[model samples]
Target: MIIKKIIIRADASIQVGTGHVMRCLALAQAWQDKGGEVIFILANKSTALENRLLSEGIKVVYLLAETGSYEDANQTVDFAQKFNAQWIVVDGYHFRAKYQKAIKDFGIRLLVFDDYGHAEHYYADLVLNQNIVVNNKDLYRNRETYTQLLLGTQYALLRREFWQWQNWQREINPITRKLLVTFGGSDPDNVTLKVIQALDWLNKDDLETIVVIGGTNPHHEVLQKEVSNSSLAISLQRNVSNMPELMAWADLAIAAGGSTNWELAFMGLPSLVITVADNQKAIATELDTQGIVIHIGWYQQITLEKIGMVVQEFIYDQSKREEMSQKGKKLVNGYGARHVTSKMANMLS
Candidate 1:
């Protein structure tokens, strides 16, 4: 059965970050490939991102209301109705229980992309928590009987670009020399600068670094200047399209504990994770405990010395890096988006 159209309610900015929008794009791409139309209702605006979505032939509807507010939900429902959307997918931490109820009140089928079960309650037709550490069913125990739970890494939503690299093999070097640093789509906290500053402590001529900054990043100028003046061999990449290639080329990664962690893991790249936000804590901790990554605590608490020490340790310990790489690859097989889309198709049918 053709699923018709799906309405996605998600936003992106320096403040809210871009994970929600990107992941939604992944699901939208899967649905689009299956002969379904996708429409996005966004509360905030990012011209570059909007253009990117438009480039993919997806419709973008700008909503002039507070994110997750009653008005926002109303606007979303209006758009969904206009498009004759078969399902509404909502992502972003700001979209809470009230927002879910508001959409459900319209008698619309809803899919909630959640993290850590932040809502006071769950009322959506489906709830997807794609984090590895989300094992406790009690988190969603308050949900409605009809609310289906799609938990764990199996449902991790990765974009179509990543799918091309699934069969790609990663070569682990005996010593770590190349590093990829990505602090999510919007490093509002400018943790990328701190990570770059910390690289100064390494003082290794052979060390090569690649730093990726999102288009919405407020500190791009500062970061570019820092990279220019730095003694380290560093390349600053903005809004990169070839992430999988970069991940494959790097021996290790210094990344924010966000959605990119899953991508890194899928690429079998051992990484040092820094929690830039509270939402990222669980991901960092779980990956650390599972030996898939080295957690460096919160971004605010981490110093240049701490970052240097971890990098040095990883560089010297080839065996440890190899182990982490294998563990990470074993954790995420990179077929999550396809799996999720298939389930969504079945649900719609």
Candidate 2:
């Protein structure tokens, strides 16, 4: 086992979304599989997210201080010491150099989950950037000599539910009909409703769509009403646990370009990615440049009518769909959490 105890510091909310927490959950699950214990130190109260963690047999602790603030790190350290945690992992943009150094000041080993090299400097024993396109790795060149970077999709931490489907083969049909639309755990801008409206414009009598909403989506009532009234065949799924199964069921996905992108890739589901966050634009563009998915530009900059036109064109592009599916499956092999956990064990040794 890898020191037996680990603590993760992350938060989920409308502003921050749930990617950090979900990815950390993947790490926590991997640790659990190795007979290790996991605890979460969060700055916000997301009841559904918290309940999901508890049901997985992991413990969660909410911090009273502001997220990523100096005091936030202080509270996290107190819990790390209380549990005698072997290592502390921090994820999210709010966790910066000060937060990392504070955790390390206690002599506890630290691992940091990074995206786009947001931190100016790092003191963590290990730093992981799981995105396929990370243009800012040079930013970490000035860090401590002991700091190690684990980059690329090879370290993509997928949830435990996806582990079983790692080896499952996808058989692409000649014609695409089924669709999956998910805009991450929190669609604060209600982009999902727009996507649904676009799907309605497709007006393909044979088309089917599943629109997934996160637990924190404040516009659920509005979205549900739209779904109930839509002429297109559509269903709304909330806080679903069978994401991998859903991915397998769909021929293609119209999704928000976030952590879920990796899941779609692992399942060999070709996607049209619409980015909601500012930083997500670069990642989406890179995925497009790499031929992994078709980037539909920033959410606000894209119109629903334009989105419908893109979907209509993509539906009949059989050759392109197959190419993207194969390329995606090759990029993410679904052993990321396994590789990361093994590295942690090696670090302790």
Candidate 3:
């Protein structure tokens, strides 16, 4: 039997962050489980992120074409044809409507992962937006008739490491102390420093935190210096392969409003979210309204005082944190990646 192959086109860096590629990695892992091959075509120059993919036995190809240009689509389609890939997955704002059409016109099945409706018109066979949108119908009303949308938290794709924690129960502390802080794979704004300073402001003797520094994060040395001088019991970890263990260990989290929130939710960890990107604003707002997370507003507008105050408030609110944890687990079941891969397999069959 011929091995089915999937071509994934996504990029990650300090500017774009790693949400697109990371979520696509979840899908890639799911496909790999089914004995399929995965190839990543990236326009990013992140050696760290590329190494992570390479470690997973996935092929990585750098794209020299101008980002969001017609050549980018051409190169992606060219790779898909060369491999005789069964599916082409495109995830990024740069892979807009015209780009989707170009891939579909080549008669290759296309899967577009989106957070917001960045595409003016979606021409992919499947458009997967794993974020909670207020209205799915309005988001893609101009999509192709054959395009099928997989929207909301139910379809949130989580990495393979999070799968085993689906049934793990968290023992919430009466007063929260342990904290996990991560701003996706690239904290472009260095929002983490604000959080660290805020933690120092708290001045609690028992407070401990594990700050995960992403591989693509350029502000590492600056952050390292800041953490080294801090009085709080904060540890800096980079390129963490055991995120689920950290999630399981933490009593609460202060994270960016990215795909990592879904993993935290799946692990039933209550969190305070800060929107580091424009696309995350709506999702964070919705999650806050649902009590899935405590949305602390945009990173730019958020002050160090505000972060301190929110953490303080959450530390005392045992009932609220417990509720958030339960609601979070219910929102994401950890099988979304497998579910999506099953759908893709069916489509291929």
Q: What tens digits encode model 3's per-residue C-alpha lDDT throughout 127-224?
A: 88888763647888889999998887778998888887777889999998899999988898889888998888887768889999888888999999
Runs in model 2 deviating more than 4 A are 1-3
Q: Give all candidate RMSDs, comma-separated.
A: 1.1, 1.2, 1.1
lDDT of 2 at 148: 89
Give residue 161's error in model 1 in angstroms.
0.8
* Candidate order by decreasing lDDT: 2, 3, 1
Model 2 Cα RMSD, Å?
1.2
Give all TM-scores, in the order shown: 0.97, 0.98, 0.98
Q: For residue 119, give model 3's deviation from the true position in Å.
A: 1.0
Model 2, global lDDT: 0.90
lDDT of each: 0.89, 0.90, 0.89
- In Å, residue 184's CA in model 3 sits off its true spot by 1.2
